[model samples]
Target chain A: MRTLLTGNYAVAEAVKLSRAKVIAAYPITPQTTIVEKLAEMVEKGELDAEFIRVESEHSALAAVYGAAIAGRRAFTATSSHGLLYMYEMVWWVANARVPLVMAMVTRTIGPPWNIHTDHTDLLTMRDSGWIISMAENVQEAFDLTIQGFRISEEVDLPFTVGLDAFQLSHTAEVVEVPDQQEVDEWLPERRQSYKVLPGNAVTIGNIGPNEYTAKLRYAMAKAIEDSRKVIEKADNSFGEKFGRKYGGLVEEYRLEGAEYVVVMAGAWCGDAKDAIDRLRDEGLPIGMMKIRYFRPFPKEEIKRLEGKEVLVVDRAFSMGYMGIFGMEVSSVIGDVTNVIAGIGGVDVGVEDFEAMFRKFASRKLQRLEWWPREVFS
Target chain B: MLTEVMILSFGGQGGVTAARILALAAVNEGMFAQAIPQFGAERRGSLVRSYLRLSDQPIRRHSSIKKADVLAIFAEKILKIVEVREFLRDGGITVLNAKHGIAEKSYCVDAAGIALSLNLVAAGWPIVNTAMAGAMAKPLEISIESVINAINSTFSGELARINARAAEIAYREVKKCQAGSST
Candidate 1:
């Protein structure tokens, strides 16, 4: 059924439909309503699950990790500062190979105390050995989340579905909610190969030698690589059942026969699509390739942009480094004109993008620069 | 076709609810729609903006509306807001909830006075979002019935009827006037 839902509510619905056995979450802006709605669902008997009310995001993830280790499908959500606070446990869950899913409602980190959308929080955990995927809208938030559980359980790694803070989190749009029976048939009960329950006791988290540490790290790295197949398989299987395919690790939009491509992710990609359509109508060759899964890092997709004018817009910066997304893409694609825009909830729209594309199309852009500075200011 | 509407009002004025209802009305008509509240400190008596977009196809632009095809003001004082004035597209339509005279390409309804007369107050301010929504329907090319149906879905029983009445009165009472009349 088609219903108007915010991005946060869509995630809660996905969690319910996924039939997550345990949910431990601490409230934070943008992500608060997601877990809150889940709690309401559980309390009202709409969803059958244990809603663990944790005082802090650290405890939230820790509780979820405990649940997952005990052979249960666990879920949690946090944003910005809360995500930073959960940093230690974030790495722990991945390294421990606890198959859990978390919703990272990407918000700008503090010092200035901003709660609006940005990629810094999500990008900060990009190297944490977790399966990271971003959603472009409310429907994708729902779809990717259900897929996140499948992907995580397949590889025995945690998954984080990154959603832009207020842009999609609070905004309402039409979303086609899949039927519960259909989703249940698509995603079966999570299979537990190993559990820390009674009678199946095994030595876990013991001190290991340096060589053992190297072996564990190697296996985790190889698991992430091999999980690429599982991710694709889940996406294809989802499309077969749900009629929506998000193109595995990366989604390409109007990239063929285009001279320039704008690379981005999250809800901003929607704006880029509109700008691309407007530019195309005016005889400009431009397209966009949205990196859906940032952790697996779509090397093949980035390589396809070889010998093209690449404009990468990063909503958050890495301080001493250039825009993190631009740096990563440039490292792979060789050269990219980075547009570091919307750092602290600043708005970037179609007009702003039109100007950027015009500069690139006319060869007026000589080097990388922050947007709105080059155009607006 | 896509129509963008920007609603400006004070925090306690139900500006966000107005935007949501308008979007729902559009969606009920089988069109794609989106409603968003401006992200910032939301406090009573403070300036607030809510955006609405209705399209024949899927509405994908998730950014704030920089330019609006239609502008609605619940607080008459918001007319002095240069940013709000600048957001209107060239030759755009505007609906205002004010007692003062209106200008060309604009419609004005005494929505606050109507809300007060109807004894409709939300958070100590006369509720005008519904009335303003009714006034917006004409310029937006949406029916009064559509607005009323959306209002009914948003509220219930007596409150719904009161809002529906507020909207109906505003729809009929809005006056068409010349251009550049200060409220």
Candidate 2:
């Protein structure tokens, strides 16, 4: 059925549909409403589940990890400072190989107390060994979340679905919500391989020898690396069931025969796509590639940019390194233009992108430029 | 084409609710709509804005409105903020909850006055979001039935009737203004 849902509520609805048995979370800005809605659903008997109220973000993730260990499909959510607070548990959940799912509302970290969109919060967890994916809109928030569960359980790795702070979190859009029965058929009950059953006790997360620790780390890495195919399988099945298909790892828009491609992720892709279309209309060869999954980086799809000049537009700058996204792309595709724009929720409209395209197409822009640089600022 | 509407008013006046109701109305009509609130350290009397976008297709850009096709102002005081007037796209329509006229393609209605008469108050101030939304719907070509239905769906019983009454008055008043206008 079609309904008007905020991105937060859409995630809550997805969790309900996914039949997550355990939801543990602490409330925080933007991300607060998602768990709040889930709590309300649990209270109202709409969704049968245990909603644990944790005192802090660290405990929130710990509670979900505990639930996962007990053989339950678990979930939690956090943003910005909350995520930073849960940093220890993030690595704990990944290292322990718990198949939990979390919705991360991306926000700028603050010394100035900003509550705006940025990728820094989620990007900081790049090496935590969790499957990370970002949604471009509210519908994708629902879709990716539903698929997140199967992907996470398949690999026994926790999954984090990232959405822009208020851009997607607070925004309400028309979403085609699928029926519960259909979703149930699409995603069967959680059959965890490892369980903390009372009679069958086994040592977990205990100190091990150097060789054992190394193998465990390698196993975690291999699971994430092998997850590329599992992610695709989940997306394909979801598409067949719900009639919506987001190209598994990356979605390419208007890239055919294009000379230049702008790389980005999350909700900003909408404006970037609009800018690309406008540039295309003006007879410029510009395209867009939106990265969905960041963990098992879609190196194959990105490597396809062999002859094309790629422009990486990042919303978060890694201080001395400039944009983290640009740095990562550079590691793969040798030379690329790094444009740091839209940090702290600065509006980068189609007009700004159009101007950038004009400059890139005309060879006026020579090197990496931070938008709203000292001059524009 | 996407129809972007930005609602400007003081906090506690239902600017965010107005955005939600507008999006709901659009969705009820089988169109795609997105509504977002401009979050900040806003107090009761502080200025606030909410954004809504409606389209036959999904809305892509989630940023705050830079150029809005329709600008609905719930407070006359906010008109002093230059950015409020600057956000309107060229040849765009403006819906104001004020007593006086403006020099553009605009419509005026005493939305707060109507809310006050209806005794709809939140935080001791007359709530004008639904009224402003009603006035906005008319100028933006949204259906009165959808606005009223949205109000009914968002609220219930006496409170719903009070807001619905305020919205109905503004909707009829704005229609009368449209009927009387030459431009």
Candidate 3:
């Protein structure tokens, strides 16, 4: 339906339609209202899900894990410190391939104690075996939530849908909410566990030999790798079902016949899109490629942006001067020439896009200057 | 031709709801619109920003409206938050929820009074966004019925009727403001 909704609410609706039976979340900025709205849904009998008001993110994911193992679809959400607190569970999520869907309102880590949008939180969890996707706007936020459920369940891996905290979480955008019946139709009832404990009581988190362990580990890797195709198929099916086609794993705008492109995830892409429109008005051939599905690291998918001057905007700095996405993009470009402009900020404004575009237009590697290293020091 | 209007306001005030009504009205006019929330708005006593990205074209990125054709401020206190003015395009309107009046440059209104007269007392507070939206709509040639339809879509049951009425009253208030100034 054409009801207007926020990115957070869109996620909540997807969670409801994903047939998740448990929702465990703690109140955090940007992501607080998502759970709050879910609680209201459960309270009003709008959703049959169990809304677990956990005291901490650690317990929140733990609660979700238990629910998932009990063979019911499960969910949880966190941001910044909350994700850090639950960092330990990330391994569990990956190792278990829990098929849970989480919405992380990506926020900057503290010390300065900021409550704004950034990618550091989600980037930190990039190595987690979850199928990750960052929303470019509310539509993707809504669409990705549905896709996350499908991909995670199909691959039997958990997925984290990233939205720049405060940015998309709070930003209202025209999100085409699918009919509940359509969502229900698209998202089949996910079997929460491999098998129920009908006296068969097989062990989860089972210990194994190195060879056995390796195969299991690769299963997690395989699922993560498999998520790209799964996402593509889901998006294709979602489009067929809902009349909204979100360009599978990555959505490109005006990229054909363009020379310069800037990359970003989450709502920052919105500002980038407008900037592209404005710049295009001025006759700039610049374009934007939004990597919606972040985790299965669609290097081949990003190969389409190859020869163009690429500037990967990493809101969260990787250990090396590049984020996992920027690194992977650069790696995929693989000796192909492109300037990497690494910039970090909470919920980038139009000025940031303008700066990046100017840098790209000139073909300069503005990394050392654009990065926020002085603060990190 | 997507017209995205981002209103930055504080909680307790109706920034999100106001954006919804405006965007909703735009939809009634047959435009595709979406309202998304942002920083400073989720917590009580904090500044909030709700953005309406509308276009004849389908919106692609879920980014904050960097340049607003109209900037609606629901809280007088939050006027300085995040350089909302920077997002204003040339000749765009900036509406503030201020008491008395703003001199120099601004589209000002005491939206509370409009709600009171409309008997939507609960819809009052952060009064300026609605009034500003109400006032700006006419100049932009957006229909009042569109605004009414938007308010109706978001507000459930009785409040739907209430906010729609408030939107109408707000429209007249803006009209009166325009009249008092020019004629």
Candidate 4:
């Protein structure tokens, strides 16, 4: 069904189609509207689920985590401080391998108390071992929320899908929502073949000493890496069945014969695509690399851009390290003159893209530090 | 050239609903229009920013609103909390929801008084926020009746009648900007 809805509303409806049995969320910007819509759906009987209302974002994730442990498909969402409040649970759920799905509308953490859109919140949880990805628009936000069901259940890990707060979450766009029959064919019921049994139950979490803890952590790392193959296979299989493909962990738009590329996530792609389209008209060899599956690192895909000058845009910062996206993309690209990007997400505008490109055109990345620069650095 | 404006208000003030009404008014006047809420955390005390990007051309960037031609501040106190200034383009209008007109050039209306006089209860009419929309329309070349139609679309049945009355009272309360007044 084609409808004009915000990314948040689209996600809420997608959860309905995915048949999530438990929904818990506390009101936070960008994320609140989604929960509100979900709450409404529960009230109206459009979406059959337990709309758990918790007083705090902490309890919200806790409810979903508990639900997932009970072997029910569960959901929760939050942004910024609300997400910060939900922070400790990320490590627990990932360790628990709960398989619940979370949608985090990213926002920059505030000292200035900003309500603008940015990726700092979501990126902060990148290493928390959740299967994380971002959405470029409402359609993907919907598609990914459903896709997460397959990825998480198969991998037996939780997933965090990032949409820019206010940027994608609130912006209304034309989205083609897949019908339930199509979605059902594309993504079937959860097949948790891991559970021992009710009659023969096994303890999932434990108070481990260093060795056991390290093994469990290494298993999570391996599981995240293993998900790379599982995700690619699932994406391909989903495309084959649905006849519409958004293949690869990273989606490339018009990059085949292009040189300069801008990496983006969430609704800001609307403007980045615009800037790319116009730059194309002017005959600039520029394109875009949009990372949808942010977790599993997608190193093989990043390796494909070896010699190309890719400009990575980060809506969130990494503080002591490089920009989160730039750092991750750097891990993939060995030694390429790629732009280390950090700019507009929620608080920034489309007009900001014009300036970022102008920087890319100049000798911006030419003098980038080579402290430990290797051939594949 | 159609003029566009944004009104930031509180939740109970009928902010989004009022903004929708004004956007519909602009559409009724044959202007290409868009009305969107500036997305953020949903809370009543926290800011509620709504955008009306009216122009001859269709708007494509449905992102954060950095600059607005006019800004309507519903709560007199929220002005201190949120970054309310520096967004307007030089001579843009700002309507305050205070009891008295601000020293700076602005439209001032006490909507609470008017809502009460009309004997409307239930939603306690965040009267000033509603009034600011009507005031904004006149300067931007939008007709008052069009805004009235917008309010009607958002609400109906028994509740709709009171809201229509609230909107009408709000229209009367708005004081227009002088032709050459420096904002």
Candidate 5:
């Protein structure tokens, strides 16, 4: 059904369609609505699921982790401080190889205290062995979430779908929600290699020797690397079934003969695309490479823009170094302009992107520039 | 064509809900729309603003509307607090919940009166959002029927009936006037 929904509600709809057996989460700004909707569905008997009201985000993920290990499809969602609060359990769940889906409505981590969009919170899990994907809009938030379960279950990995706080979470837009029968036909039952059954006495994540720990880490690394294909395949299958396919790991927009490419992720990519379109209409050779999947970083796709003038716009930065995403893209493309913009939800509109593209095309922008310069000045 | 609307209202006045209803109405009319409520640490009676974008094509830009093609003020008192002229584009339409029109392309409607007449009072405040939404339909280029359907689908029972009636009354009574004109 085509209906208007916020990204949070769309995610809840996806979870309902995915038939998540367990829903556990702690309330946090932006992310609260996703789980709230789920709880409402559960209460109204519209969805058959156990809605666990955990006191903290830590217990939220832990509850879902326990449920997933018991071979039940489970889900949880958090943002900003809530995600940080669940940091330890995040690693535990990922290393345990329990298939679960998490909706991360990304918010800025703060000392002054902010509840707005940024990638810093989600990017903190870069090496946690979880599959991370970002959605650019409400429809993709629904699509990526449904696909997250399919990919996670296939690879026995935890998946986190990130959408910008407020921009996607609070903004209501049209989303094509697939029928439960259609989703069920596309998503199979949760496949766990080994379930922690009631009769089975199994001690998972026991104390391991140095080599054993290294070996487990190696396996996780290999599984995630292999899961890239699974991600692509799931996306292709979803596209075929739902008639909507965002490019597997990275979606490209008019990058064919472009001399300059802007790479970004999250909801702002929509604005960036609009900027690129306007710039292209003005005869400027600029395109955008939106990173749909952040973890298992799209190195292959970044390599395609090797010779082009690549500009990476990161909403989150790795203090004392540079933008996290820019660092990764630069590592692959050798040299690229890195601009740290939109931090703490400082609005970066189409005009801002158009100006950035124009500056990059004219070789006027510095290699690393803080946007809305006055903030840094 | 893209029409951006900025709705200014006090918190708890359903300014955000008004934007949502209008967006839904636009969608029901086979157009793409986005309703973005400015999320903030706000309380009841605080100044709040929400945005709506209606377009024939998909809306890719998610930023806050800097210059709005239409400014819908839910409370006439909000005019004293917020400079509506600053947010509106050149020759933009103004839909004010007031007895008199305030701008060159202003549309005036007694949304509060309609809401009160319909007994649509919540927390001692007249619920003028639906009436204001109906007052906005003509200027937004969306059919009044679509707005009515959206209201019906959004609310339920007798509340939906009264709210839809308020919208209908406001739609019929909304008057367009020149700058500073009472009629």
Candidate 6:
């Protein structure tokens, strides 16, 4: 059914449709509404699930991790500080190879105290063994979330679906929710590779010798790398079932024969596409490469841009280095223009992108620049 | 065509809800719409701004509206406090929740008076959002039936009926004015 929903609410709806067995989350701005709606559903008997109210974000993920170990489909959501608070548990969930889903409403980590959108929070987990995917709009948020469960379980890895803090979280748009029966058929019951039963004796996360630990880490590294095909398969299956598929891993918009390509992720890609369309109308050879899955980093897709004049727009900076995504893209595509903008949720509109592409096409932009300039100055 | 709408009101006046209702109504009318509430640490009675975009095609731009094609002012006095004129595009239609029309190419509805008559009071303040949403339909180029359905879906039973009634009255009683002359 087509209904109006915010990105947060859309994720919650997907969780309900996925028949998540347990939901434990500590409420934070942007992310609060997601769990709030789930809690309401659980309360009203609309969804049959245990709405676990934990004291902190740490306990929230830990509870979900525990639930997942017991072979129950589980979910947990958190934002900036809440995510940081659950940092240790993040590694624990990933290393344990628990199949669970987390909705990460990306926000800026604060010193001046902000509750706004930024990619830094989610990017910080790039090396943490979790499958990370970013959604560009509310419908994609819903699609990626439902896909997260199947993809995670298929790879026996945890998956995190990210949407911009307020830009996507609070913004409401039309989302076509699939029927529960269809979703149930698409996402079958959880099949656990290993479970922590009461009668079984198994120790997870036990201290091991250096070589053993290194080997386990290597296995995890390989699993995430292998998950690339699983992610693509999940997206294709979802598209086949629901008639909506966001080009697997990375969605390229008007990149054919383009001279300048803007590569980025998150909600702003919608605005970027709008700007790109206008630029295309003016006959400018510019397009956008939206990174749908941030990790395992979509290396193959990034490699496709090897010969293009790429401009990487990163909402998260890597302090003393370049933008986190910029660094990654540059490492693959050689030295391309890396511009950091929209940090702390400062609005980057169509006009801003239009001007940036214009400057980029004219070769008037620097190799590394911070939007609004004063942000770094 | 894309019609950008800016809804300006104080926090607690249901500005965000108004945006949602407008967007929902647009969707019900078979158009794509997006409702974006300006994000900030806002408190009650402080200024609040929300945006709505109704388009024949999917809305891909998620940024806050820079220039609005339709400006809906929930409270008339906000015009004094904020330079709202800068945000409205030239020749854009203004929908004012006022007793009298104040601008050319504008529509006015006494939303507060309509709300109070309908006893739609929340937190001791008149609930003028639905009524204003009703007043905006004609200017927004959306059918009043869609607005009524949206209000009905957003509320329940008696509340929905009263709110829909308020919108109906506003739709019928809204005054279209030209250069300060109310019609």
Best-fitting candidate, scored by lDDT: 5
Q: Which stretches of candidate 3 lie over 4 Å from their true place?
A: A198-200, A278-284, A304-307, A335-347, A371-377, B2-11, B34-38, B41-53, B60-68, B71-89, B94-110, B116-133, B156-162, B176-183
Stronger candidate by DockQ (2 vs 3) = 2
Q: How do all the candidates rank in terms of TM-score, highest first?
A: 5, 6, 2, 1, 3, 4
**Local distance difference test scores for all models:** 0.88, 0.87, 0.71, 0.72, 0.92, 0.90
Worst 10-residue lDDT window, candidate 3 chain B = B174-183
TM-score of chain A of 1: 0.97
Q: Write the per-residue lDDT of candidate 6 for residues B1-183, one digit (tens) a residue.
A: 989999999988888998999899999988999999888665789888999999999999888888899999999778778887787898888888875554567888889999999999989999899999989998887888999999999999999999899989998989896445332
Model 3 residue A216 CA deviation in Å: 1.6
Better of 4 and 6 by lDDT: 6
Candidate 1: interface RMSD equals 0.8
Writing each residue's lDDT as its tens digit, candidate 4 over B73-108 gives 777676667766666666677766654443345676
Best by DockQ: 6
Evaluated on chain A only, model 6 obtains a TM-score of 0.98
All candidates: DockQ: 0.73, 0.75, 0.46, 0.24, 0.83, 0.85
- Residue A152, model 3: lDDT of 77
* Stretches of candidate 1 exceeding 4 Å from the true structure: A198-203, A374-377, B80-83, B101-103, B179-182
Per-residue lDDT of candidate 6, residues A16-89 (tens digit): 99999999999899799999999999999999999899999999999999899989999999999999999999
Task: Give lDDT tens digits, candidate 2, residues A1-377.
Answer: 99888899999999999999999999888799999999999999999899998899999999999889999999999999999999999999999999989999998899778888889999989999999999999999999999999999999999999999888998888889999999999989999767896787787799879999999999998999999999998989889989999888999899898999888898989877888888888888889888999988999989998789888888878887768888888889898888888888777777788888777777766567878556565
Fraction of native A-B contacts kept, per candidate: 0.67, 0.80, 0.60, 0.33, 0.75, 0.80
Cα error, residue B33 of model 3, in Å, equals 3.0
lDDT winner between candidates 1 and 3: 1
| Model 2: CA > 4 A from native | A198-200, A374-377, B81-83, B175-183
True lDDT of residue A273, candidate 6: 94
Worst 10 residues of 3 chain A by lDDT: A335-344
Models 1 onward score TM values of 0.95, 0.96, 0.85, 0.73, 0.98, 0.98
TM-score of chain B of each: 0.92, 0.90, 0.75, 0.81, 0.95, 0.94
